[model samples]
Target: MQRIVLFLLTNLAIMLVLSVTLSILMSVFGIDRQGLGGLLMLAFVFGFGGAFISLLMSKWMAKRSVGAYVIEQPQNNTEKWLLDTVKRYSDKAGIGMPEVALYQSPDMNAFATGANKNNALVAVSTGLLENMSQTEAEAVIGHEISHVANGDMVTLTLVQGVMNTFVIFLARLIAGVIDNATRGNNNQGGGLGGIAYFAVVFVLEMILGVLASIVVAWFSRKREFRADIGALEKLKHSQESQLEGSMMAFGINNKSKFISLFASHPPLDVRIKALRDSQ
Candidate 1:
C-alpha cells in the first residue's frame, strides 16, 4: 500500500512540475494556443521530459518504497555472496557494478531499475532469498543484469514517452473540439466552457492512460522474454534448470490475472515454455 501511494504521489508531483514548466515555456516562446504544431511540440517536450525525469528518480524511489538497504559492506555470508554474484555478472556484462540491495517482502520478487546500464540498482526481496536456492537466486540476478546490459529501462522509458506524447496531444485536441461544440450550442463563447474543457481532458487522459498502459504492458512482456534469454546466455549451460525453475517460481508465486492487461511480466507458463524452447 505504501508503494502504491508513493507511486501515485510521485506521478502527481511529476505532472505538477511538468505543468508548471510547460506553462513557462509556452509563455516564453509566445507559442500560439491555436497552433497545432506548437501544441504537438509542447506535448513531446513534457512527455519525454517527464519520462526521463522519472527514470532519473527511479533508484531513489525504489529504495524508499521498499525500504531497500544497499550493502556497502558485506555483513554476513549471504550478503557477501549476493555482492560477489552481482559483481561477477556485472563484470561479464561489461557494465558498471550496480548497487545491490535487499528489501523486505513476503513475495518472491526482484527488480532492476536505473537511468542507465552503468548506474543501476538490483534489488531482491528477503522472501526471494529465503525461498529460492542459491542457484535460482543467481538466475534471478542474471535476469536483472540482462535488463541493465540490454538497456531495457531506457528503451521502456522511450516507449512510454512516445505513448505519453500521443495521449496528451489527442486528449487536449478532443477536449478543445468538445468545448468548442459546447460553446457553439450555448451561444456563449467563453464562460463555463473552460471548466468543461478541463473536465473532459482529465477524463480523456484517464481513459487514454489505461489504453496506453496496455501498450506498455505488451512491451514489458516482450522484454521479460528477452531478459530471460539474456540471463540464460550469461549463466552456464548446466544452470538451465535453475533458470527455468526460478522463472516458474516467480510466475507461480506472483502471478495474478486481475489486471493482466497492465501486467509488466508475461504469464509464468508462457515464460517457462519460452525458456525451454530456447534450450
Candidate 2:
C-alpha cells in the first residue's frame, strides 16, 4: 500500500517536472508544443514499460548469475529466526515479504532487487556470512530489506528508462518538425537543420542524463542512511548492540581495493559516522 502510494506520487512528480521544463523550452526556442508533447508521451510509455519489464526479469537474472539458493520458507529453528526478522522488519517498513536467497561470492556485498517491494529478492555474498557474526549479518539483512521497502531499484530503473526514451524520441521529433517548418526558405537551414537539431538534442540529453544520474545516485546514498537507521532501530528495539558491531565488522574491509565502486551500500566510515552521530 505504501509502495503503491510512493510510486504514484514519484511518477507524478517526474511528469510534472518534465512538463514544466518542456513548456519553458518550447516557448523559449519557438518549438512546436504538439510535437514536444507527442515526443514526451511516447517517452513516458516506453520508459515506464521498459523499466517495469526489467524489474520482472531481475530475479531470474540474479539467480542465474549468482547461483542463488532460495530456501523453502524457513522450516527449522534457525531458519525461523531469519524469516521472522525479515517479516517483522518488512511489516514495520510497510512492504511485502521478499524471497530471501544466499549466494556464493568472494566479495562482501549484498543487494535487494525486484519489480515491487513485495515480490523482491535479497541476496548476500558468502563472504559476508563467513566473516561477520550473526548480529552483523542481521544488520546487513535489515539494510538490504530497506532497499526493497524504499523502492530504490525500481525508481532507478524508471528514471533511466525515461531518460533513454527521451533521448531517442526528442532528437528525431525535433528534427522532423524543423525540416517541415522550413520547407524551401533557406537551403542552408534545410540542409543542415536536421544535423544541428540532432547535435543539440544529443548533447543536451547527454548532459542532462549525467546530471539526472547524479540525482539518482544522491537519492541512493540518502536511502542508505535511512536503511541504516532502520537497522539500528530494529536492533535497538530487540535489545541487541549487534547492529553497530556488525556494521563495524563489515567496515573492516581495507583489503578489498575496489569495494567502493562495486558496493551499493555506502562506505563503512560514512555508516559508522552516521550511526555514532545518531546517538
Candidate 3:
C-alpha cells in the first residue's frame, strides 16, 4: 500500500512539474499551441519527454525511493556475497556489473532500474537477505540481472511514452471537436465553450489515462515473465525447482490477483505455474 501510494504520488508530481515547466517555457518562447501540428508537438513533448526524463533519473529515483545505498566496498561477508551474486549473474546476462545497493525493507522486494542496460543499479532489501536462502537470493538477483540485460527499463519507457502521446493527443482532439460542435463555430474564448472544452478534456483525460495505465501495466507484467525466464536462462545450474522457487519468492507481495490490468506482476501462482510448465 505504501509503495502504491508512493508510485501514484511520484508520477503525479512528475506530471505536474512537467506541465508547469513546459507551459512556462512554451509561453516564454511564444510557441503557438493552436493547431493539429502544435497539439501533436505538445503531446509528444509532454509524453515522450516525461518518459525520457524519468528514465534518465531512474537510478537516482530508485535509490531514494527505496532508501538504498550502493555498496562501494563489501563491509561484511553478506555484502560480499550480494556483490558476487550480482556480478556473476550480470556476467552471464552479458551486461556490465550494475551497482548493487541494500535498502531497509522488511518486505521481500528488490528491483532493477537505471537509464539503460549497461548503466544500471540493482538493489536488494535487507529483509530479503534476512529471509531468503542462498539459492532463493541467487534467483532473485538473477531476475534483476535479467531485467537489466533485456533493457526492460528502456522498452518500458518507450511503451509509456507512446501511450502517453496517444492519450494526450486523442483527449485534446476529441475535446476540440465536441467544443466546436457545441458552440457552432465560435472563435472566442471563455463562457460555456471554454468550460465545455475543459470539462470534456478533463473527463477524457481521466478515461484515457486509465486506459493508458492498463496498457502500460500489461506491458510491465509481460516483462516480468520475460525477466523470470531470462533469470532462469542466466543461472548456470538453474532447474525447474529453482525457477519455481525463485519466482514464488519474488511474488510474495505480488498484487496482480484482483486488478490484473493495473497490477505490475502476474499473480504468484500463475508465475510459478508458468515457470514449471516452461521447464
Q: Write the per-residue lDDT of candidate 2 for residues 27-134, one digit (tens) a residue.
A: 575655346666676566655665577668877767665677876666676556666777777888898888877666555556677788889987666666565566
Candidate 3 residue-wise lDDT, 78-118, digit = tens: 99999999989888988989999998766555778888788
lDDT, model 2: 0.58
lDDT of 1 by residue, 1-279 (tens): 454456556655555455556556766988634567998999998888878987898888777766789999999999999999999999999999999999776666678889989999988777677766788778888888988899988998999899989877787788766656656445566523544655566667667876987898788788786535433332222211111211222221235555568777776567767977888
CA lDDT of each candidate? 0.71, 0.58, 0.69
Per-residue error (Å), model 1, residue 160:
0.7
Q: TM-score order of candidates, best first?
A: 1, 3, 2
Misplaced by over 4 Å in model 2 are: 1-34, 73-84, 91-94, 161-166, 169-185, 188-211, 227-265
* Winner on lDDT (2 vs 3): 3
- Which candidate leads in TM-score? 1
TM for candidate 3 is: 0.79
